[model samples]
Every structure is written in structure tokens, then in C-alpha cells.
Target chain A: MFSPLIDELINALRILPGVGPKSAQRMALHLLERDKPGAAKLASSLQQAIEHVGRCKLCRTLTEQDICATCTNPQRDSRLLCVVETPADVLAIEQAGNYSGRYFVLLGHLSPIDGIGPEDIGIDVLLERLQNEHIEELILATNPTIEGEATAHYLAEQAKRLEVRVSRIAHGVPLGGELEYIDGGTLAHAFNSRQGL
Target chain B: MFSPLIDELINALRILPGVGPKSAQRMALHLLERDKPGAAKLASSLQQAIEHVGRCKLCRTLTEQDICATCTNPQRDSRLLCVVETPADVLAIEQAGNYSGRYFVLLGHLSPIDGIGPEDIGIDVLLERLQNEHIEELILATNPTIEGEATAHYLAEQAKRLEVRVSRIAHGVPLGGELEYIDGGTLAHAFNSRQGL
Candidate 1:
């Protein structure tokens, strides 16, 4: 409402997820009013990231180099590859500190209704990696959503043909989750997957 | 977590209001994965805004020029001044499609406990405008918070000396609000401010 520059900035800020017009305007004003230096730093950083960051050729995870840190790290278990829908999932798995395997980021899941299929998400690239690499086990760590399940099952079928062992991450009530609050689908999954404890 | 450029971008993005580590990472990854061109555009827009947008010389609101459009517009009621806490408040008032008056942005309210006082919020500049301009009415549109009340009271006293009429925006139940769900203070205000219906 103030000026064209501010309007442009506000519109540009809407690219960030979950930011509505009001929030974008607030952000624009906040940057102009209180944090100009920080805004300038953010701008330069965004430019640098946009110019340098790209998908790692091997795993499709975001990186500035040819291969990502996880893919290049010799210490990680190269024989056990975890496949996830997005880089955020990779970060979550890393934060859990349980998995030491490398990752293959699908960047998105297969959604036929949305016209997103195997080839759309670089499944052929993942299959090529499976055939060439020494990976013994492929862990499907995609989300529990419908699209994620379909993608995982399709990848498992593809991996089977290449003689690679495939496994899906367990789906159940989360840790510290109350049984009463858990949804029906999750409760059912937890019940069906119950093992000797 | 992925690369130096990505890490830097994520850290820089945390400066935005409500953005945390996880949100920053998600934004970084989403930009790298989906909208590189949009990211670049946002960067340039941010840089341009940072370089151009500054506080209006008259009202302290954000603007690309020395004076904001509202302050410069001749059709708006210059004799009626609306004093608000921030530029966001100005935008909110404008979006409501009411109040055809000029604005004076205080940037913040008088929070004595936080070591913020009248001078810190440009009270002197407001007094100068009151004295120099032919303003007939001063609308105190600050927030309903304690600090905002104190600021409004202080400005009212200052405006009284200059013989400018002062009025505060009513604090009452919001439009379409149910009394059952309204807070005690708001309900009390609503009851006290009840007008002829």
C-alpha cells in the first residue's frame, strides 16, 4: 500500500510457504523498518544459494556440489540407502541419530492424479544408481501419505527386479503418542505391525 | 546441513518473523528444489527494497521516497491525523477501507519497563507536526495493550496543549463477535461503550 518497491517485495516474499499477503506485508515492513542490514544479508545469501545450490547428481538431494555431503561421506553406510520424499525428511532422519545410511531424495512423491509419476520424480535416475552402486538394502522412508505409499511400493518393485533388497519404514503411532489420540489408520497400522516386545 | 551456501541461506532466513530452524531449512530446500527462478527474483526484490525503502520523513512510515504516498496525497484529510504504533497498523487500517486521514507511525509504544519512553518513539516529532500543521483532530489508533494506552494518554496530553481535538479508537467486542466467547476486558469495554441503537 505504501510504494511499488514494497508491493514487489511483499509479493516476492509470498514464495515462502505458509506466508499469506498480510504476513508478507508484515515481513516487508519489518525488514524495511527494523532489519535492513539483515534483509540485505538475507538477499545476498538467497542469491548465492539460488546460483550455487542444485540437485546432487547421484541422489537428487539439494547441494552446491556435484554430490551432496551424505553421498560423498565415506563414513556413512553406502550399502544401506534411505529413500525419502524431500530433503526435510533427510534432516529429520539425521536429527533422530538412528540411521547412518546415505540418502536418495525423490524431491517429490508419485501422484498420478497430479500427473506426477515415476519419470517425473527421476525414478530412472534412482534405478540407475541402484544398478551401479553397491547398495545392499533400500529403505523406503517416504511419508505415510497415499502418494508416498504408492511411490515406495513402486520403487520396491523396481528394486526387486535389480536384485536389491527393499524395506519400508514402520508406520505406527509416534513415540510418546497417547493411544486415545492416535488416528484410526495409525492405530490400525500399529496394531497390525505389533511384534514381540 | 547440506552445503555451506544452503546452511548460510537457512541461517539468514531465520531472521524473518516466526521462522525457526526447521522452517528455514524447509524454505531453503523448497527454493532449491522447486523455484530457483522465484528465489532469484525474491533475492533481487529484497536487495532493491533494502536499497530503496526508507521511513517517510514526515510520518516515519515505510516508503521508497522521502514522503509516503499517504502523506503526499492531497485528497486525504490532512486536518485529521491518525497516530498508530507501526506501519502494519497503518496497512490494517487501510485494508479496512475506512479512515481517510493522514498517519503518524510511532514505530513502538511507551514501554517504560522495557526502557522505551516517549522520546524513543518520536513523541517530539509528533508534537512538532501537531504544532506546525493545521490538524483539527488527532485519532489515537494505537493498540489496546497497556503500553499503547500509556502512549495514547501521553500523546493526548501533548495534543491538548496545542488545542487539537483528540479521540481514541474504541476498544470493544470485535465485529461479528459473540459475547459468550469474548474476553472479560473486551466485554466490559463493549458494555461501557454501548451507544444509542
Candidate 2:
């Protein structure tokens, strides 16, 4: 049958979520049969990332050096800070190309059931950074999940004592969507956060 | 937010078939956070397989040594040889656990349009092997595609002159499938290969 090497390659590809044995096998075969350059690129990238990427000393986001480009950029607004649950979330916001503020990555959200607390997720570090960084505004850009909401609310309360303006991203029926198809949570949020048209 | 290493890892994972940017980001983060053991296992397996498994000198299947265990085993019916397109196909048949005969892996199917001919897919090597070996029955287990059919026909013609019994795998509606939904090619195959109940 296929070489053990092929199987290993297939299994390695299966590290992606939702990729089962069959999908892994297909991917491995495809890499071998067609995309040699792509496969080599992927392998080299994996090795390099594993060897080089580390947490930013200032913001806790993933970075190649002690400080991320966002933190080091003098042109960015140091007075405006956006907080998110993970490093990936920061990238998602950055990709939108609208946000011109600095960011703080939490590494995780508050999950009391899982024993994850604010302190555990670097809240103390964030607080220290907030006080010292001369920030005027704090945007809690965490996801709309229950844990994300709790974390954001907790951060807002903390920011109030520090005399920094805090705000949450509004939740509503999505753009270009039917109200009837929207979920109960979003519907409730839409009703609560309603504005006169 | 995420480290450059994490970004690179996500990009690497995205190169796989069916993986998008979001999925790759999720997967890279997952491996870093929860599936460390799985990732390490996968990496170790990759290194091991790459270092260990090689092509079987006889059948072209993956093997730890020069000849595959299947090819060298004395208990197998060497006279009744099954031909498949790849080592993966051999494993599939083996998993089915019905075929006791030995196998010859072609490494690839013939595709004349892609400049892959009979010899390029190892048909000449197969012929030489057949001439030297003690094979009686040659079962063609190539896939059910147009290229697979053409290769089977060519092999059958070649084996016909050699006076060896040749058979192609039956093509029809799959087991547990309904006849009403069966395609024309399968219906025709079923009609031709029909057996009395």
C-alpha cells in the first residue's frame, strides 16, 4: 500500500480540525501527486514558525520579536486600545483595515467552569499596561460568546475605576440578513440595543 | 495579535486541501493550546515515516525494506496477482480482508493526456515482473475512471498474448445503494454482470 511516509504526511495534515483519515489521505496524495512546491512551502513554514514565533513582551500577542509591529509603530494611536481574547482575533480585526488603534491580546477568555479566571488570562498584565500606556479609550472586542461577554464586562468595570472610556461592539441582526432567520440571542440584543430609525 | 510564528503556522496549514484561512487559524491555535501531544505525535510520525519508509523494489508499494512484507510473504498466493494504481489502494483491499493474493502497485494510473503512458506508470516493469514471476491470474484493480478503464484494457491486451487469465473489477451500484438512484454506467454494468439470485 502507500508508504509509511505517506501515512505520516497524511496524519500530519489531519492536525487541522474536522480533517478525518480519508481527508488526510486525500490531502497527502494530492501533495505528492501535484503540489510539490506548495507542500515544501508548507513544511518549511511549519518548521520556521515552530522554531521562531513567540509571545510579544508588551501585548502578549504572537510576534517574531519582543514587540509586535503594531506596538512598535509610532504612527498607531497609543491612546486607543482594543482588547481581544486571542492573537488570531487581533488579526481578524486588522484584516478588516478599519481599526487604527493598538491591541492587547488576552491569550484566553474567562471560563469559570473551566477554572480560567481574569488573572489567569493576563488581566493583571493588561491592567498594568493600561495604567502605564497612557490609553484614553478601551474597546472590548471579544467575541459575543457568553465567556467573551463576561470577560469584556469585567474589563469594562475595571477600566471605569481607572477613568478610561470603555465600550463594547454592538450586537444586532447581521448585515444583509433576514430578521426572521436571526437567532434568539441576536434578536434580543437587537431589541435591547435598538435605535430610532 | 498572534505571534508571527502562529501566523506562519496558520498559513502553512491553509495550504492543505479544503482548509481555508479561518480553519487554518483555528487549527494552528488548537495545536498550540490543546493538542500539543497530538501535534508532537504527528511531527514525530512525520519524521519517522520520512526517514524509514521507501518504495518496494518489486511492487512499488511503501516498504521499510527493499521488498514489501506482502511481496515477500510465503503464505500469499503469488500466482494470483492483483494490480492496483497505488499503495493506498492495496491497503483499502487489505482492509476489506477478502483478498488473499499478492499485489503489484503501479504508483499511478495511466493518463495519456497528461503525458503519462503505460510505461511511465510502470506497465513495462510490471510486464517484466510478470515474465520472471509465477503469476497465473492478473486482476486489474485500477479506479473506475476513464483513464483507469484505458489502462485496464491495455494491460488485459498485453496479458492476453502472454496466455494469463485476466479480470477487471466489476463496476455497478455500490452495496446498500438503491437502483432508482443508480447512474446509467452502473445500471449497464449491473445488467451485464447480473447473477441469478
Candidate 3:
């Protein structure tokens, strides 16, 4: 019922995750009503990021530069490498704040049905980086899913051949989660990594 | 915890309606993951709309032209004018698919407390348009809220003094709404306009 321009705007807004027709209409109305500058800013930023950002050549993380800021930062420990399945995973690990190391971003997890393999998702590039950077340890920080596990295992074997120590992140109960409600996999992990209190 | 760029992206995403911190982060990650072009589309549309859209001088409705399409349409019954509180209200009435009249957008409802008055929301312009366009019937299609009611009443009185016929839309139980749960005011209206079975 709206003009074609408004319809195009609504369609553009619906591209966001979880935004449906009604939500898109509401957002478009709001942009038209209260926030012209904010809307303009968002559009400009989206265009700029989409046009400019690409995978960091070294780590495959999303970045404006060929080498991401993380890769170029001298203060970050280059010897400890955290391997993750996606750029988002890198951000999540970074948010948790315990690791002071660098990252290796795989575009996707190992999904056999999808024809994704180690070589397809920059694992070769990671190995090359590890060899060139003299990385002392590699941490498998991919999710605890089956594909993540397989990817980690494959990377661990590869790292071993290169004489680099390989380890996986511990997964048990999340922070503040009750032990009584913990799942079987988590309980098993906690048990396997048992240490003296 | 992530890069300043990611933080900026997340903060920008939060400007969308119902997008909290978690949802903002999720959207930011989603853009970083699978839908860079989609995100770019949203941003580009936002900027384009912001740059392109301006209020119609005649109706105060959002439009790319000095006059909105609704106001400019020669075939629409110029003598039958509908008054609404905002441009969105105009769209809502248009979507109902029954109104074939031109519109006057108030830009906002009457709010004396916020110092919003007749002149503040282009009441004079509406009057001038009504006279200039030779409108005979004015439909008070503002919302049902207290402010909306006040504005409608005020405009209705003005239209009466101007010798233009004024009519308020009938309100009763909405379609698919339970009549038993309808408020007294609406029930009274329904009774007053009761049709013969």
C-alpha cells in the first residue's frame, strides 16, 4: 500500500535477522518519523563496512585492513593461537577475556554434507601462519559440536606433526550454571579434566 | 571485548527497535558471518531514505517531492479530506483500502503540556489547504487516544465554523475482537449505531 520507495525500504529492513514484514514496516515508519540522521548513519555505516571489510589475510577474520588489527598488534601474544570456526567465534572468545593470544578464523565448521573440508576453510593458511610465526601452542576453541570436535582433532594431529603443542578449551558448566542441571557431555568433560580442590 | 569496529557495529545495530544488547551483538555477528550484503542494503536504504524523504508541504506526509503522492493525486476526491495525526496514520488508513480522499497530516497530536499547539503542528496550513482546495467534507480519522480525541474535537469545531461538514469514524468492537470484553465507550457506540438484523 506504500510507495515503491517505502516498499524497497521495508524490504531492505527485513534483511535483518528476526525482522519480518510487520517489524520492517514499524522500523521504516520509525526511521521516517523520529530518526532521519540515525537512519542515514546506519545506512552509511552498513555501506562502508560492506564495501570495505574483508577477511584478514593472515587470520581470516573480518577486517578493513589486509592484516587485521589483532594480527598487527604487537602486544598480543603471537605464540598462543586460538583457533575458531568463524569470525563471530573469535569475538565471543575475545569477550570472555582470559586469552591474551591471537586467533585463526575458519569461515565454517567441518560439515561433510556441505562438502566443507580442512583445506576449504583456510586450514592450510593457518598451518602456514603457525609455521611462519613460530607459534608455540595452538588452542582449539571451536564450539563443542561434533563438527567442531572433528576440526579440532584434525588440527591437533596436524599441529603435532609440526611439533606444536595442541590443546582444546575446557567445556563443562557455563559460568554460574548449576552442576545439577549440567548435561552429560559437560559432566563428562568436567570429570575428565578433574583436578585436586 | 572485540575490536572497536565490532563494538561500533553492535551499538549501531541496537538503534533498531526491540534490539537489546544481546540481539544487537547477534545481529552484528550475523552481518559479520553470512549477510554482509544484506546489512549493507539496510544501511544504504536508511541513508537514501534519510537523504531523499521530506515532508509534504501540503499534507506533512513523508514524500520525495514537495507534495506527497496522496496530496498530488488529482483523481482522489479533493472535496473529501481525511485528517490524521502522522504520516504513518495516513498509511494505515490507506491500507484499510476504503478511504479515497486526500489527507492532512498533523505531524503530531495536540499536547498542550509539551507546548504543542495548533500552529506548532500546521493546523493553519491545513485550514489554508482546505480553503484553497475547496474541500466540502472533512473526516476526523485521528486515533482514539485522549490526545487524538482532543485534536479531532478541536479540528471538528474548526471545520464546523468553516461551514465544512465534519464526521468522526464509528468505533465499536473491532473485527475478530470479543464484544463482551469491549470497553463501555465502544459498547455504547455499538449500541447507538446498532443495525437491524
lDDT per residue as tens, model 1, A1-197 = 76999999999999998889978887888888888889999999998888888888888888889988888898999999999988888888988898999998888999999999898888988899899989999999999998899999999999999999999999899999999999999999888999997
In model 2, what are the clashing residue pairs, if there are any?
A1-B87, A2-B87, A62-B2, A62-B3, A63-B3, A87-B2
lDDT of each: 0.91, 0.81, 0.83
- Candidate topping DockQ: 1
The better-scoring model by lDDT among 2 and 3 is 3
What range of 10 consecutive residues in model 3 chain B has the weakest lDDT sum?
B1-10
User: What's the residue-level lDDT of B174 in candidate 3?
Assistant: 91
The list of candidate 3 runs beyond 4 A from truth reads A178-197, B1-6, B179-197
Native contacts kept (model 3)? 0.52
Interface RMSD (Å), every candidate = 1.0, 3.3, 2.0
- Between candidates 1 and 2, name the one with more favorable DockQ: 1
**Candidate 1, which segments miss by more than 4 Å at Cα?**
A112-117, B193-197
Estimate, for each residue in B61-176, the C-alpha lDDT of model 3 and write its tens digit.
88878888887788898889899888778878888888888988888889999999999988888877766768989999889999999999999988888888999987778999
Error of 3 at B156 (Å): 1.9
Which pairs of residues collide in candidate 3? A43-B43
lDDT rank order: 1, 3, 2
The sequence of per-residue lDDT tens digits that candidate 2 reaches over residues B1-197 is 46556777777777778889888888877776556566666555555555566678888887668888888889998898899998779889998998999988887788878999888888998898778887899999999889888889999999988888899987888999998998998899889989888
Docking level for model 1: medium
